[model samples]
Target: MPVPSPYALLLSNVMVREASVSVLDSSTSYWDYGPPNADTVVVAVHGFRGEHHGLDPVVAHLSGIRVISPDLPGFGESEPLRDLTHDIAGYTAWLRAFIEALGLHAPVILGHSFGSIVVSAAVAGGVEASKVILVNPIAAPALSGPNGFLSRLTLLYYRAGRALPPKLGGALLSNWLIVRFMSLLLAQSPDRDLRRWVHDQHHTYFSRYATRDSVVEGFEASISADVSQFAPSITAPTLLIGADRDPITTVDAQRRLVELFPDARLEIIPAVGHLIHYEKPREAASAIVEFLGDGAVAVSEAAA
Candidate 1:
C-alpha cells in the first residue's frame, strides 16, 4: 500500500531501549504533520491490534495541527516487548517512555477503543495531558460481565491458539476468518464504503503475531483492571464518543465513563459501530477540532 505524502511534515522512527519495561523490542514511529512551528500537538493512539494508519482520517482532518501517532509495542513496525508485558501497565509505561523520549509535554491525546482505555489509565495514574479524546472507549462494566458459554469457549480457543507456533496459527486462521470475525462486531448495516474501510484496516493494522498477542493479553487485562476506580483521578478534559449501535462500547458504558470523569463531554453517534472514527470520521474529527481549538479562547474555554 502506498503511503500518502504529508504536507510539510517530518517523519522518522527510532528503537527505544527501556530497561524498566518488559517489552520484546520497543520502537517508535512518528509523523510531524502540518507546520513545524504549529503550537498545538495532537497525539493519537490506535486500538487493540491497530497501527498508526488506523488514525489516518483523524490526522488528515487536523491537517494544520501537529499530529503524532505511533504503533504500540508489537504492532506495526515496532518490535514487541521482550518481556512480553502486553498488559495495560506495560503499555502505559511504553507510552510514558515514548513521550519522554520524544519530549512531548501535555499533548492532546486521541485514543480509539483499547487506546482509550490506555489513556484513561494514564490519566488515572496522574499522567498529564492537555486534553483527551476517547473514541468508542471500552465500557469497563460491560466487558467484565458474564458472556455466553460459547463465547467463553471461543475465547479459550484463541488462548490455546496463541500458545501454538506463530506460523501454524497464521496458517490455521486465515485472514478471511479474521475479517469475517471483525465484521461481526461492526454494524450489520454498515455502508459499503465503510465496510471496505474496515477491511482495509484489518489488513493494514493487524499483524498475525500482534493480533494474537494483543487479544490474549488485552482480554485478561481488561477484565482484571477496575477502570472505574481510575476515572475520578483523571484531571485532563476528556471527550467521550460512543456509538448507540456499537456492539462493544454500549451507550450505558459510555455514560458510566462520563459520570466517572470529573470533566468530560459525551457524544453519542447514532447508527454507528465501535469504529466510530471510520464510520463517522468527519463528525468525529470535527468534534476534536472544536474541542482543541486554535488561539483566541483560553484553555478553560476550549476545554469547556
Candidate 2:
C-alpha cells in the first residue's frame, strides 16, 4: 500500500516522470521533476537507504527548477554497479559517470545526508557543478560527534546483519521494528503527524537495496567519510541547510563544516533533525532557491 504524501496538493500541478539512463553498466532509475527546459537543473542525490521517493517532498516545494533525483546504485530501483563495491569510491565514480551521461554542462548539484559525502567527493574529483546544496549534510565523520555513541551502535547493528546468513541477514536488516527505531532516532519533530509520516516513509523504503552486501558497503561509505573531507577541494559556491536539532550531525559540527569550504554558507533550521527533507522540505527548498538565484525563484514563490 502506498502512503499518500501530504504534499501531494502542492505538487499537484508539477510535471513528474520516471527517467532512466545507463551509467557505469547500470540502468539508473531517477525521477525528473518540473519543467524540462528550466534553466536551473539540479542533480539531487538522496541519502543512504533512500530512493528518489525520499526526496520527493523537497521536489514538491521546488516548482520551477528541473530536479533529477536518482536512486543511487544498489538502492531502490537501481541495480548495483556491475563490478564495484558500493563504497565511497564506487559511488563517487558512479556519480561522476552519471552526471557526464546526462550531458548537461555544469548543472547545479545537491546532496542530502550520505549523499552529501558522495556529491562532495564527486565535485572534488572533477564533476562540474555551478553550485552545490546539502540538506542535513553529514558534515563530520559519523563516529566523532555528539552522536558517536549512537553511530557505534548502528555500526554493530550492521555488523550483526552482515554476519548472518544471506536470507536471515536481509530479513533482519529490513525488519519493521528496526526500521521504525531508526526513524524514531532521526525524526525529532514535535508534530506527531509528521513523525508518523517519517516513520512510514522509512518503513516503506529503507530496506529496498539490491543486496545485503551492497547495503553494508554503502553504510561503511556513509560513516567512514563526510562532506568536510572533500569540502576544501570543492571550488564552487555551496549551501548547507543544517538542522539545529539533527541527531546525525550536530549544528555545531555543521558550523565547523561551513568553515572548511572556501565559498560555503550554512542555514540552520530549528526543531528538526536528520530527516529535514521529510520534516522541513519547504525550509530546505527556500534556502536552495536563495542560493540558486533567479532560476530558482519559482520554488520560493511556490513554498510561500
Candidate 3:
C-alpha cells in the first residue's frame, strides 16, 4: 500500500484545526494546535514551498503551549500578497500585523528555514516576542558555499520556468518526477523509512502549495537577506537548533548566528539534516520543552 499524503494524515489528527485570520487585506490560513487559552503561544513558521502541516510532527510532541503555524502568503491555503515583494521585509511586515490582529502579545516565535529569516527580520524591526527559536536557520552568504551555489542554480531554473506560459511553466516546475528526484537528493536521514516518508511529503506539498512567482521571489529574497546586521537589535532570549548533517545550513553556520545575537545559545541535533523537526520530532520537542520550561505551560495549574 502507498503511504498517505502528509496533509491527509495531518487532517486525521485531532490536535490540529484549520483556521484563518485577515491581515493586510488578505485572508491568511493557518493550523492552530493545542489549547486556545495557553499562556505560551508559539507562532510556528514553515520554510519555502512549505505549508503549516510540515511542522505538525513537532507540534504533536509539544504540550501546554498553543502552536499557530501559518501557510505564509502564496504558499499554502493563504492568499498571496497583492502588489508586494515576497521578501523578508514583506513577510516581516505581514507577521507584525498578523500577530497584533490575533492579539498575541509577546508570543514565542518559532521559525524554521526561510521562516527563521522572517522571524529574525520581525524581531529586528522591533516586533516584541518573549522568546525566539530558530530551527535549521540559514547562514550568512559568507558562510554558505556549495549550498549557496545550488540555490542560485535553482533560482535560474525557476526564472527560466517562469518565462513560459502559465500552464507549461507550472507543469514543468511542479513535475512529480523532478520533485521526487530533488527530494532524494536532499534526504540525509540514515533511516530508509523516514527518508521515504520525507520524500513523499515534499513531493505532495511542492507539487501544489507554491507557484513559480512565489518560488522565484522567495529564493531571491533569501539570497539577498542579511539578518546578522539586525542581531544586536533583538532583545529576546533566542535558541538556535542546527542539524549535524544538514548541508544547506551547517552547524557551523548556526554557531555563527549565535555569536551575532545578544543573548543566544546553540544546540546541534545528531544525524539529522535540515528537516530536523520531521526526522526527530521527539528529540526536538524535548529540547524545546526544556528550553521553554514553565513558560510553555498553558495554566498555572498545568505548570505545577
Candidate 4:
C-alpha cells in the first residue's frame, strides 16, 4: 500500500496532555526547510486533501527563515480529532497548541486553501503571528453572508450519507465521487492527473477516518465557524495570493478577502492553479522573503 508521492511521511509522534486528553495522538509530520535559528519563522498549512510533500519544494527554496509545514489533523500522520469535531476552528486551536508545544515564535503564518480558513480563525482568535499570507485560500464566502448555508448543507449531507448502510457508504466516500464533486464545484479545469492526485490523497489520508458521521461533524463544524467575527480582529499584516486560473478560490474571492482585513495585500499569480505555493514555490518564498525583509511596514506601503 504505497502512498502518493505528494504525501511523504514525516513523523508519527503523538501529544498527550494532563487530564487524560491526548492532545496529539498521531505522528506530526512537516516539510521543514531553511535555518532553525533563522531570524524569521514561517509556518505553512496545507489545503484540504493536501499534505506536506506538496509544500516540500516551497519550504526548500526558503532560506534564512525557519519554515514549518505541518500536516493537518486527520489529513496526514496527525490523528483525527476525537468524535470528529475537526472543523477549521478546531484545527486552528490544534495548530496554536502545536506552535506553543514546539516553543516557536508566532512567526509568519502562511496558509494554502483550507489552511487559509484556519489561519484566519487563528489570527482572529488572537494567535500571535508577526504576519499572515494566504495562498489561493478557500472559505472566502464564510467571511461574509448567506453564511450559514454551507455549514448547514454539509451537516445535512453527513446525516443523509450516514443513513445508508456502511457498504453503500462507499459510494459517498469513493474517490471518484469526491473528485467529481470537486471538479464540478472547485476545479475549473479538472484534468486526469489532477483528478488522480485528488483520489490518491483521499485514499491515503482520509479514507479511514472519513466516515459519514465524522465528515458530517467536520462539515457542521466548518460551516458553523464564525470567521467574520475573527477577520476584523486580525492585527497582523495580511497578504492574499490568488491564482488567476484557480477554481477553488478565485480572484474575486481574494478581492473580497482584502475588505475583511484591517491591513492586507493581494497578489494575483498568472498561469497558475489553486496551489500557488506548490506551483511556484521559489516565487512564493520570495514573496515571504520580501515581506520579512521589510517587517510590517512594507505591507502597509504595498497595500496603499
Question: Which one is best on lDDT?
Answer: 2
Q: List the residue pairs that clash in candidate 2.
A: none
Query: Per-residue error at 54 for model 4, in Å?
Result: 3.2
Please, what is the whole-model Cα lDDT of each candidate in the order they appear? 0.66, 0.87, 0.78, 0.62
TM match of model 4 to true structure: 0.72
- Which lDDT tens digits does candidate 3 get at residues 1-304? 4555333343344366787998898889988887788778899988878888788778866776788988888887888777677888788988998899888898999988888888989998999999999888876662257666776777777787788899988887888887887787767878777787898788777755456787778767777775566677788998888888887776766778789998988889998888887887766777788888842312123223
Tell me each candidate's TM-score: 0.81, 0.95, 0.90, 0.72
lDDT of 2 at 226: 88
* Backbone clash tally (model 1): 6
Find the number of clashing residue pairs for candidate 2.
0
lDDT of 4 at 222: 49
Off by over 4 Å in 2: 295-304
Best-to-worst TM-score order: 2, 3, 1, 4
Winner by lDDT between candidate 3 and candidate 2: 2
The best-first sequence of candidates by lDDT reads 2, 3, 1, 4
The lowest-lDDT stretch of 10 consecutive residues in candidate 3 is: 295-304
lDDT of 1 by residue, 121-192 (tens): 776776679998888887664334543343466566667767889877665444567656775566343466
